[model samples]
Target chain A: MSITWPLFIQVTLRLLEGFETTCLIFALTLVLALPLGLVISFGSMSKFKPLAYITKVFVWIIRGVPLMLQIFVVFYVPRLIWDLPAFSRFNAVILAFVINYACYFSEIYRGGIESISKGQYEAGQVLGMTKTQIFFKVILMQVVKRIIPPMSNEIITLVKDTALARVIMVAEILKVAEEYAGYALIWPLFYTAVYYLAFVGILTLLFGFFERKLSYYKV
Target chain B: MAFLEVKNIKKKFGSNEVLKDISFSLEKGEVLAIIGSSGSGKTTLLRCLNFLEKADDGVISVDGNLLFDGSDRSTTSDKNIRRKRLHFGLVFQSFNLFPQYTALKNIMLAPEMLLKERAKKEKLSAHQKREEHEKIVAHAKELLDSVGLSAKEKSYPCELSGGQCQRVAIARALALSPDVLCFDEPTSALDPELTGEVLRVIRNLKSSDRTMIVVTHEMEFARNVADKVIFMSDGVIEEAGTPEEVFDNPKSERTREFLNRPGF
Candidate 1:
């Protein structure tokens, strides 16, 4: 059946709303996970053996499991093990995404931070900067510049991964499109690709802008 | 009490001892140059002086303040070491200017972040704090001017040449006005031609009454600028004396060997 212009607008607006939720999940996960990733990186890189080992193993487990499976585990395991009520689908989806992405981001952060020469730290220390001062003032921005490329890649992947929220019954873009597909209109499913492409295209441009801005650091 | 005193500083890396019983004392306005081949622990000794590398056994005093007693380096909290570290400013061979900062910002950062934090802790009035901030900014500008990089104050480390970056690094180190300045092969990272520009800046510092400890391979600079010269041979001081005594009338076989190498 051919869709009229009004019908197309209606479908597009509905998908846009769904995309809003997708963006929210993406944004919140990033906001929480980025700083959390840095903290986890410190843990993974800690001089204390037990803390470092535990953090590394946890990161490994999170990264080793599939995101979809992690979503299931996040949604079900708390209730299974503790007899707690299930969390909201949005909460469960974000929880899983945040934990999984944080592990990935922490590894990237650790690599970026560790790759900095020991001399940089020494330079800061000699200036009488405290450890916290050294990390925040000297190390943090340089680490941000170094990690941006890999970080942007992960973020772009997160744009696509937001669809996985559907596994937890969160009505993000893909799930919304799937609902339309039940009406024998497959065009809406194809239509979902347009949203993802536009979203990712915008992200790619944003990341390109950041990379250009940070190029001044020169490694 | 000397202006700077380092007593029996020893350091180890795993199975290898990098610095062994290194001791030195500097008077106010005196410059000491440490010359040695790579792996001789000259750099390590300098690093230990600033508590950058924890010494296994030693005592360091700067302006009569005890930095740490190496008998228990671990027991010395990081806070104590960092506070004591303010007494010494170190310039690296690689000119580790913060790459993300402009040359002026590199000089301004330590003073701004540090002095402001200290002022904040004292609960200084905003007007007082503002005065402190302005003072640091003006001082940073003056330092940039002194280094002959006033025109390049806005330039990032990547934009500056090797000598310019080292000068900026020197300016940054000097921004805090530490009791002593330590240079670890400051010119080794520059081109032979560019090395002259940095050496000239350092030579200017020689007459300024700043106590300095330089670890370098520039024999001519060592002879000309240093009041005393130390020849480090395999983690120990093979010879240390006035420039004439060490350079002209070499005594130790190892010191003579290092000075009389094929290049010399």
Candidate 2:
């Protein structure tokens, strides 16, 4: 097929609009999930047996199911149970993505936190620091250093996982590419691969920088 | 009155009974070395003294002020526990220096937090807070120098040798000037050559009349430096006396066997 300059430009612009939706899903999920994951991790690690068990089971359920199935459940379950109006397609995608990613992030957080030696907490305690102070001032950065590699891997996976929104018919980049495939123009579908590669490449660089910055400490 | 006193400190973990009964007293300017085999509860006693572990029963008084009383519910509050912990500083066997911070910053951190808290409580002006911060930095530098690591202020824990890290840990513990500084096998993690540097800094602290409790496996160090020596066995003190009296003339069978072990 002969490709004209205008045709390529037109396809690029439409894909960019769809890419905005993809980016929004990625950014919003991260913004909401990062802190929420920390809270969930604390709940799982709580001294209260009931709270800890419930949080653990919740995280287990979220992780055991597939992401595509989760998106569908979020979109359909509320309306089915309550006879309420279905959520907006975008909100359902966001809700499902947040819960899924937060559970994964919480496990990474728990691993990083539990890896620290008990001696660190005892050192802080003997120095007269409160439990909160010990966490923020002493343990937090060490945990960050330990979790960065795992966190970055999960984050890069999220960038691609945004395409899962297409299952909910959210007109994300992949959905736009698929729409072109219906027109029997296969090149734009290949062009979509370029965008994902660039996005992941940039993220790889960013995470590498953070890893180096935190490399001064060997936790 | 003793400078520090403990009455029947008892601790248990799941009925294991790690410390059945521990009681001791230290006068000001005295060094008390607690010598014991592993599992003898020496470390637990130190942890309890620092409030890292709560003793099930005990009375701990520092400078003649009651710090912890198991019978007193009012003394066990979170706020009271933190305040009481300030009376003691502990150096761990592993030299748990904050790895992300430099030696100087590790020493400065707790004191800075303390100063910040005081500044808020006192409603100090911005200028006053800045001045207090400078004082903390200066004090931290002085502590680093005292531990003979003046040249290593900016090095992280990973960059330092085990001995160097322990010295920094010592400086960090001394930054707050606790009434009683405790060491829980402080040199046990170092190489034979490296142990000397840390021991030297501790010996200097002794000459300065800093009250201390040292839990150690070093028999010679305990005999030469400690004014009082305790031999612990099976969660209790098997023998307690002057170093000469304990080492030269041990009364307990366990103390005699422990001192005559192959390594000693």
Candidate 3:
């Protein structure tokens, strides 16, 4: 079989449109998850019993369910249960990814926070720092540094999982390939691997740079 | 009431009483050494006065202002007692210098944020604030000089030796210039040789008019620098008196036996 440049360009342009959707979901999830994860971590660690319990239970439910199922539920359940108009397909995909990743990030947050010794907290108190000051000024950077490796792994996984949105025909890269494959030739289906491998490849290097920047943490 | 007073202070960990009716007082500039074996509740008493432990039942006063009564340790309405704590400084055995911060930032943190947080910052004019900041830096330098850590300002805690770390801890404590400095086993973490190095710095502090309360096992330190000595055991005061009277002629059998031993 011969490699064809003209056909490649046609598929690449169509794939690019689908790639744009993937990028949008990735960007939105990060913006939402970073702060939302912090809020969830705080809730899980709250001194009040009820808030802590509720946060933990919510995290457990989200984490236990499949992301594909969650996407379906979040996208379709409101329409089914309430007989209301459904959210836009793109919005539903974003909402699902945000909720899923936030739970994962919360666990990473909890593990990072718990890894720091209790002695550190007592030391902060002895200096007369309020609990807020201790968390932000003392423990915050350490948690960020500690959570990066696990968070990066999940993020790369998230990039690939954007293809999961194609399940609902949201026109992700793979779905774009499916359209072109049926029309022109089936080879574009194989070409979809090019986009995925490239996306994941770039993310890997970005995480490497991020980890190097945080090397001062030493832990 | 004395310059610093503790009355009926009790601390318990779920029914295992760490301190029972612990009471003591100190005049300004006096060095009172609290000596006892491990688990004697010596550290607990010091923690109580600072409201670090939140005593189960107690009344504590500093400079004629009651700090902790029953449960709450002086709310915003009780500014006088709050003022007293700001005047108290604590040094610990572990040196507790924030691992992430430089020594200079560690010393400057409390005075800078604490005053700003309490809104007493208006007392300092911009010129004075800059001057005060410079003075804290200068004083932190002097304190580091006094404790023999002048070369270690930029180093993190992990890079420093145990002796250097303890000196930084002392510098961090003295940076506040509190009315009283309370040490909770300050030398317990160091070897015998390094113990002398820290004790020498502490002995140098004796000539100044600052009040000090030292929780220690070093009998010689208690005898050499203390104006008064307190021996505690099993959550209660066993004996307390002038250094000479307590060490030279101990009244309690417990004190005599404890002093003669190599360890407290």
Candidate 4:
């Protein structure tokens, strides 16, 4: 248990490698989920009863269950039901995270969009803009401004949730720390806090910037 | 033929009737003011004309072009409705300017979209599109100037006062150059002092011969500015005439009582 430069550097490098995986999962989940969430929100809000109901029920199921269990389901259910080869642990983690986050994000999107007063739509209609034109041109930015605060909260949560990837042996940063702890070196596990805090700190500053940029308008 | 004619415009909200057989006509260069108590359907009538609400039964014609026919489903298609909506621009009482855009961009947006569409249809070159966009900007500036908001072009709706925001909304509505402009109580959301500035803008618009329908609670504004005044009660026109006849010598008991109310 001697504290040495080599041991510190080795632990740092190993954690950095695992942190890369964490960052990848977080980045890819966000890139894929944001737009997919919007589309799902539209489906939930659709005028078509069946589509809306089905989307709502799907969102309901995804949100009602625990994320870890969902990961297990995603990883194992295909093999169980279809007799197919198991998906890579990383892919399963991604699939579960995207589906779960997209559902949560869809609810946030729906709330932001529906919170806009009817007057805005009426104003656009009276100006002779089509529904599509009205949405993209008039409503979209306002919705973006309104959703930013809530979206940032969910996004920060996603940063922490990347730890869940370790359950399926995806070997994210926390898992690397756990491996060090198993060697009876407990301090390296506590050291994982530095990486997470730094990552969340950057995200907080970025979201703050966006919120300020959109502060020119009040929704 | 009337420049704008609405025949038997009826609207209902589930079990409740909001507008009942509301019929009126406006000649070019005239201002028609509708005065009514709340729930009397004045706003609903304006909404129907602007295609914000589809009247359960009606025929609307602007400049002799039949824009809406409730009996014929063909005329009520989404594309046709949007096209017909261009004939009437509505200014809401709440002054619903797009908050994300500046006052000038709020006015310019619809026209910019329209010009872009037309440019695409005519296969105009990129330079021509830019020229058209410049024209739209110039026109929006002119409209802002007309509403006495020339210096506030860069201000967001949140930055502007209620009256200034309404003026921007007025300019935004005028940017489309509809055949008729409609206002659903433009001053209702403003303070008594702020109300004067917006009312002044509407009065100025009148001298320039803009045809307008104003649904208002301001009895004085209605009486002083309207060429024709309509008194609505219980989803019907209680009285319709020149301001003198309607306000000074109301024919219906309801109209007379409404006019005598303390605020009026």
Candidate 5:
């Protein structure tokens, strides 16, 4: 019960193990969601009314409801309705996180794309570049440049939101801290904050680096 | 047949007709200047020539090849439209250079892409394609030299002045080797002091055999460079003739009124 440095190190290392799971959820969600969001954004901005409307409504429903509820549904609904086997707990958490974050990222992508002036497209067209060429070569880099700040914000939030996986018994850092708290080890609970702050701080620096790299595009 | 021609072109946006019975023809090596107040459809007419705005009714022929027969979409196949677009290049008033690319790359991109497309069409071997690509890069460098921006080839659009950016845009347009080059008030976006640099570039291009259609407010430059001058009023060609006839002795009352207006 003595608050020894060695004891603190031992607890921190154990919490770091759980934090690895949190980091995995965050990284995988981002890797899967970023491009998925772009595809979804295209659907939302489709010229076809039925397609665009359907995508908008789907995004609206996902965003309107709570993430925790979405996780619960993702975890339990398939087996309940179809008498099918449930997904593994980690996979269920990832599925919920990917769908939820992809919708948010889609809105950011949509805004970034729409904010570009029509002149850029016209310029590309006049240069005899095809629509695909224009989108990839001219528009995509600019969109990336414009969306990075907002995307970083969402990604940082995702890092914190990974704690939500504990609701499904995923044993992420917060869950590990909760176990310690149950044993009257209150200090370990606050220790999780340092991990989160350090992770978020590194992400902030990384995003700032990206913003600087894209500075050549002043518009 | 003229090198480029538009027959009875008409365009309307909603209930407002922007171009009414517009028609013009340009011979190879001709420099035609279109002059009008804002809303006179000068820019719209230029855009129509590039197929940026499809006319409600018209026929456009570049080098006597029909690029558009507005009533028939099937004849204007996507491939044909794209091929025909290569015959004309447009420089925007706003410059419209890709902000992310350096000046050299801006000039080089379309040419390189088009060369690759052409290589596919011609079924060239890899060695032949590399040789052809080298030629394009050489031509792109020549274009930059012509625009007098050889020193700033590596500068992005934001790093360049408005005049410098416009010049880079001109170089980009020329890199495609179009039969005709069109300008839409190329200097209007520049400060008064910066206008001369761009106008000088355009003026140097006047003697070249590349057919040019310039929509400009600089009456003096137009008089000096244009083989033909058109006065547009209310979406129609009020008068058109040699520069001397249009500027010094305008036949139409509207043309005279516009020419005589203060600050024109």
Candidate 6:
């Protein structure tokens, strides 16, 4: 039960590598999901019946199933259906993460867009702006302002969910914890929670700063 | 041809036919006011003129451009429709300004982007573009001055009152230099004192060169400002005539019931 300071530092450094992977997935998923969610929200709210229905159904299916099932499906479904080159486990993990978060983000997208009055659209059109221009210049920032707090909450959750990647042995942070635990035991497993809580705390501070900076915006 | 025209326009929204074969036309400088009870399609009809809501049938041509040609909705290109849309300006029931942008930037954006292509088409040089920016920004300032909101030039929408927001919305619309201006309940979201402020701004634009169409519930304002009044109910024009003709005379029971309300 003797404390081992040098080994502890090494274990922390090893865990840092896993934390980097976690941050990578977190950042990439957000980079992909924000715009993808906007596009999905647009399609779901489109005047075209077919595109609207398709987007809605797609989001619904992704949201309905558990993330674990989505992870398994992404890993196996393409190979089963196409018989093409198998995807790397990392690719499957990203695919599952993107699709799952995109759906959640789409609902936030939809809510933010819908909360804007139809009058805004009319005003944009009357000003001779195209629909796309209106969405970006007028509707876009409002949607961002509206969705940020909710988006931040979901995003921090996504940071922790990177451990879920370990379910498929993707070698993310939790996997790094278990690896160290086999050699040393006990506390390393508990140490994994510290990384998550610290990451989430940082995320919360960032979101608070963002919201304050955007305070001038009013719908 | 009239400067703007709406011919036999019909619009239905999800089993609700809101406008049935409505037709209207306007010269370049006239102001037309539309008054009706709630669900009377006054707003819907105004929306159709700008192609904000596409009419299920008939045509709305602005500045002689075919905005809606009664083709299958799928066949109509949004791109083509948008080109015609630049011909009109609109103010809404809620002051739908881009809340994040300051009043100056709110008015500057559409002109900067949409008219950048326009400037290129006209082959203006960079010096001319810079000059145009100064002129536009000044014009926007002048517009706010006319509307009594010049002091609020740098304020966000949240910092302004509802009336001031509506005035800024009007200024933003005017910055487009559109052929026609449309108001959907300009005072509906304002308090009485604020409503007077907004209506005063709209009233001062009486001598403006552009045409105007208003969907308003303010009978006194409409009776004073409008050359003619078009009454709507149940997705159709219940009656159309001068304010005196429609408000004073009894043509349709619906219009009668509307004007006879405690205030009107």
- Spell out the clash pairs found in candidate 3: none
Question: Is candidate 5 or 6 superior in DockQ?
Answer: 5
**What ranges in model 4 sit over 4 Å off?**
none
By summed lDDT, the worst window of 10 consecutive residues in model 3 chain B runs over: B73-82
For model 1 the TM-score comes to: 0.95
- Candidate 5 regions exceeding 4 Å error are B77-79, B120-125
* lDDT of candidate 2 over A106-129, digit per residue (tens): 999999999999989988988888
For model 5, the local distance difference test gives 0.91
Candidates' C-alpha lDDT: 0.90, 0.93, 0.81, 0.92, 0.91, 0.83
C-alpha lDDT (0 to 100) for residue B159 of candidate 2: 97
Tell me model 1's lDDT, rounded to 2 decimals. 0.90
Best candidate per DockQ, number? 2
- The parts of candidate 2 lying over 4 Å away from their true place are B77-79
Task: Give the worst 10-residue stretch by lDDT in candidate 1 chain B.
Answer: B70-79
Comparison by TM-score, 2 against 3, better one: 2
lDDT of each residue in B20-61, candidate 1, tens digit only: 888889998999999989999998888887878778888888
TM-score of chain B of each: 0.96, 0.98, 0.88, 0.97, 0.95, 0.92
TM-score of 2: 0.98
Best by lDDT: 2
Candidate 5 TM-score for chain A = 0.98
Clashing pairs in 2: none
Better of 3 and 4 by lDDT: 4
Per-residue CA lDDT of candidate 6, range A37-142, in tens?
Answer: 7778889989999999999999989999988889888888888999877778888888899989988998998998899888677667777777788888888888
Instruction: DockQ for every model, please.
Output: 0.78, 0.89, 0.40, 0.88, 0.76, 0.61
Pairs clashing within candidate 1: none
